[model samples]
Target: MNIQKLAFVILLFISFTICSFPSTSYACKCVEPKSPTKELRESTAVFSGKVIDQLEKGRTQFVLFEVKETWKGLNESQAIVETVNSSSSCGYEFEDGKEYIVYTNETDGHLEVSLCSRTHLLSAASEDLDKLGKGEEPSEQVTLDLSDEDEPPVWMMLSLLVVGFGLAVFYGIKRVKKKVNK
Candidate 1:
């Protein structure tokens, strides 16, 4: 019957879709990291700081740091550095309350860190610290919060509204169908 052929076609399409699009993960491909001296020269900000707070939104992570020492670029006591949300996305994972010597580059107007950067936990950066030599305290005090950094994307807000509207319409249709069947 025509219905059997239609069912077969639908099944074939589903199978093809599933087989064609296997689950995939992004893998970060980075060139070998440079030396601390070379990396410091390439950076927009180089400082040792403790992570105070972090906020993840979509694919971006905003990290707030309390700056302890400034070797280059940073003049403020507080700085916010942005990174990708995943290691697969080349993001460096910064744990809360942990001190780190961070190297960041200016990317698209934001100071961004990556797994490829010459950044490390404070405890692990002794050799780099010795090579880096003297550091000065941050001169200016500035406060930055994760909330002040990002607002939800307009497309995300619109997509949510559309999904909510669709669900309400589907519920109304189901109720109408049930009443008609009664």
Candidate 2:
């Protein structure tokens, strides 16, 4: 190869490598968090609840809470709160069975929380709770018995029974036919 052509190829290779390895950075950063009073004023919902369940769908998480107290938007015994699924995306790490004082905002008609918010585990939020004072019970509280309402619907149970009976009858007929043939 000619010296000029070789130098041009080397430069092109270097340029391509630089472009291919362009550095990308990501992190969850929050400014100085607001005080409890300011957070209370700014938050769309302020409540204390236990994390009953969490469902992660792609980059989003749906957290079910058995709400214990309400200071703002929450009015039901149970609430579903949405959040980013990852901590790198600033999502809160909620533990199943643990309580929390959650400060949330309304996004796209749903409640969302993040590490950037003043939300914290109830064990770590004593100061905020004291500052906020006593919270009220949810206005529309109702307990659902998993033993009853969450059982398979009647149609589903009946379908299972019918399928079981049909399988039993088919096996019985097959056994009788084999015996007669013998």
Candidate 3:
């Protein structure tokens, strides 16, 4: 119940609260089910093909494509059309032997795409976050280069020196007062 003990307990409580705050996470970074195949999940490639086969592989449904339009950065160059049971929020429907465009972007090496969108079809125009990884350079150019010898911006160094001098003066006065008290 002493003041020092109460202050220590309060400090400990504050430290614990600050340390326990929730951390941020990216879902795409996690590993996915084996059956779905990493290629089918995070590929940024696009190709046109007919859905020739569809089936369930383990917990995941897959669809095969017979590639017609070839492009760089997709799962593969080509495959005979096939369909497997799959679901997505991007509004793509699969039917046997139907010719359509297949767009895939893999997250954590898992495939995802906005099916049937104009942007998806135009591979060059893809704006998916997966395609453009985090911390991308802004398209606009703005440069503020500081020279190697550039002193800390004058104002910053001045303020810091002022604070240091103030602390020194405070301690000096305290020492003088203690000596006089003695």
- Candidate 3 backbone clash number: 22
Model 2, 1-182: lDDT tens digits are: 34455457656865886698776545899999999999999999999999998877647788888999999888889888888877888988899999999999998998999889999888899889889999999989676332223556658987897698567656766676677678
TM-score of each: 0.72, 0.64, 0.33
Error of 2 at 53 (Å): 0.5
Off by over 4 Å in 2: 1-26, 142-182
Off by over 4 Å in 3: 1-43, 57-59, 75-88, 119-182
- The 10-residue segment of model 2 with minimum total lDDT is 144-153
Q: Which of 1 and 3 is ahead in TM-score? A: 1
Query: What is the alpha-carbon lDDT of model 3 when measured against the actual structure?
Result: 0.46
- Best model number under TM-score: 1
Q: Per-residue lDDT of 15-41 in model 3, one digit per residue for the tens?
A: 886698776432222233222123334
lDDT, candidate 1, 63-162, per-residue tens: 9999999899989999999999898989999999999999999988899999999888999999879989979999998988787545778699978976
Q: Looking at candidate 3, what is the lDDT of residue 9?
A: 65
